[model samples]
Target: MSSRQTEVMPNFEQTLLKKRGSALTDGLSFIAYGAQAIANDEFSKCFAPKPRNKVISYLLKGLKAPLSIAGMGIRYFLLLPIRIFILFGASAGFFIALPIVLRLKSERLKRLLFKLYCKAFLWSWGSKIRYHGKKPVLDEPHIFVSNHTSIIDYIVLSSHGFPHATVAQRQGGIIGYFQKNILKLNGSLNFDRSQKNDRSVIAQKMREHVFNTEKSPLLIFPEGTCVNNEYTVLFHKGAFELGAKVAPVAIKYDKSWADAYWHSRTQTFSSQ
Candidate 1:
């Protein structure tokens, strides 16, 4: 080859290598950002395995496998059917009475029915909620903001008869049905987060709801997503933006019996 061609070939190869190196670096940075987003100490504990005891650790380790298997079998064979029956019975009762409840002229009557349903549903799931502090009077418009750890947060709040409208992400299947029908009846707004304009539209509605005394109080999980019960994340400012009296609600789940934190990435709602 000519001297000029030889020199050009080396330069072209160097340029190709530099481009590959740049692309690889960018890929790694993107991965690092994603890791940082979800890998904080508190968040990581959501999926962390239970710690082993130091006393008789070897004996405990030997029994762990059989114990885990037995636990799974008991849950699947014994508890699963009971849970299904309870949920089905509660849902059936709600839907059967919903139409009649809607027809009632009294808003108070409807709210009473809703509260009863919520209590029954929660009871069926074996939730023992001990509420403290003075209950807010439902006569005025107020915004209730709380840290969200699971879907059960809605029922727990509603069971208290706050008469609050919820702002939440749109879900599908059974949850979607409840959000669309039951929650909508109470002026709750569910939005598709994937849509660019949905947030703006929902924010406007929330402001309007807060201003309108005729509407129920607004209930919001300002964190915009569930955090592990161990730690709280920064909240979205939209709830605070609405000029209204904001009452903060705190919910602590008892993890010894069962974990209430919904690990959305790794577990489905039904599975949880």
Candidate 2:
């Protein structure tokens, strides 16, 4: 066979391997979905009302709401110290490890670190994530779009296995400094969303980064601000102009145990 044919054979083999891997993952995912559905059904049946008085049921629900809130408050205060430790510790660790990751040019390691940090951070806050859909294949540049609801929305989404650099607003102060620098190391982009000129420049940069850089995938929450995950806001068409593939991901936090929504106006920086 010619050298060209030999090279083409390897590419064909790689494609076949990818297909098989995807098939196996799909099979396992289906099984997991089936099991989860069964478990949810069983749980609902177990807790379902047993022909009880409607008045009593309503009264109990009324009582449970306040009790649940109080319980969340207690848990938050109890875990305050640990949460603070994780925040600062993870920040420090990320910076310390970032230079090495950059020097080594290891995007995979960066992604793994980001994933672990997000999972740990969310767990500290008493929130657990349950994924329900297939994650987008990030083999090529695809705009990862999701609804913005909470400060921790990024954490939950990153933990869902799509590892991509995110776009965050530029800010000032120590936390902001840390965010700007650390995220920069991980191939994240920042821009001033207020100015139209800046937005135009940022859109151009996004297209270049997604197509030319060949680094990692890009994630952008088109909603300019968090809206408590109630409704989606208008998405900026900047990323869409590139005409790249789009990946839509739905992020839903289990609000039964903890309130994950971050109210920027009322919430203090140290509170969460």
Candidate 3:
């Protein structure tokens, strides 16, 4: 009985081994077919043409250069007339409004109008003001000193929310007429620098404005005339002797884009 049992066990083990070998062979054949399919798919993609969206992207990139330039040209021609109108309109409106502002006795209204005019004038030129350090004192009268760079410096100072008047030297002709009228309307003082007695007269006038009057602060570009922004000339001593509180002010502007310096020899006031 033991021998017959041993013979049956050997036949059963042999059948199990044959089944396992057949399963392993079938699995390897399936893996080889799958790998071949993957390789063929990747190879086809390498030769395929680019996608429709990619082609359109290249086309738009080629057009961007010319399209951007055309857009800028269109914008300039469209806005040119408006800028010119604003410049002339602001100039005319300034002169027209000056007389009315001057006649008003209210100091508050005068300052408000003058500030508005300065802002409008600067806006027409697309100028931007960047202020630094202490501002002008309003409670008590003080001498406001700054370096002279351009006639536009006064306009920029006027926009500083102070009703201060500027000290200017006398001029002649139509230029002088407009200048005197505008400065006088703002209650600014002008003196003849060529005259020997003018200094005494100016000193007395400044003393009265500082000590006697109850108005805005007095502003003076002590250098007298416009300097090359790089260096300053000697300052006049009239503003210093008033014995009042002195506030030193510095004014700077972007000279690269809109240089306001009017040297008279090279640049005219209107040109600046």
Question: What TM-scores do the predictions have?
Answer: 0.71, 0.65, 0.66
List candidate 1 stretches off by more than 4 Å.
1-86
| Model 3 residue-pair collision total | 0
Write model 3 residue lDDT over 1-272, tens digit each, in one string. Answer: 01222221234435555665677775775576567566644333322322223432343476585775665566477555666677688778776866676686777777887787777777766677788765745566577898887777888888876656877877666568856776676557888867989888878888878774566678888877776564556787766889888888776655443445566655557765
User: TM-score-based ranking, best first?
Assistant: 1, 3, 2
Error of 1 at 79 (Å): 7.8
Winner of 2 and 3 under lDDT: 3
Q: Write the per-residue lDDT of candidate 2 for residues 83-111, one digit (tens) a residue.
A: 77887787688668777877887768877
Can you write out model 1's per-residue Cα lDDT over 202-233, one digit (the tens) per residue?
Answer: 88998888888776677899988877776677
Give lDDT: candidate 2, residue 51.
37
Model 1 pairs whose backbones collide? none
Candidate 1: lDDT over CA atoms?
0.75
Using lDDT, give the best candidate's number. Answer: 1
How high is the lDDT of residue 51 in model 3? Answer: 24
What's the best-to-worst order under lDDT?
Answer: 1, 3, 2
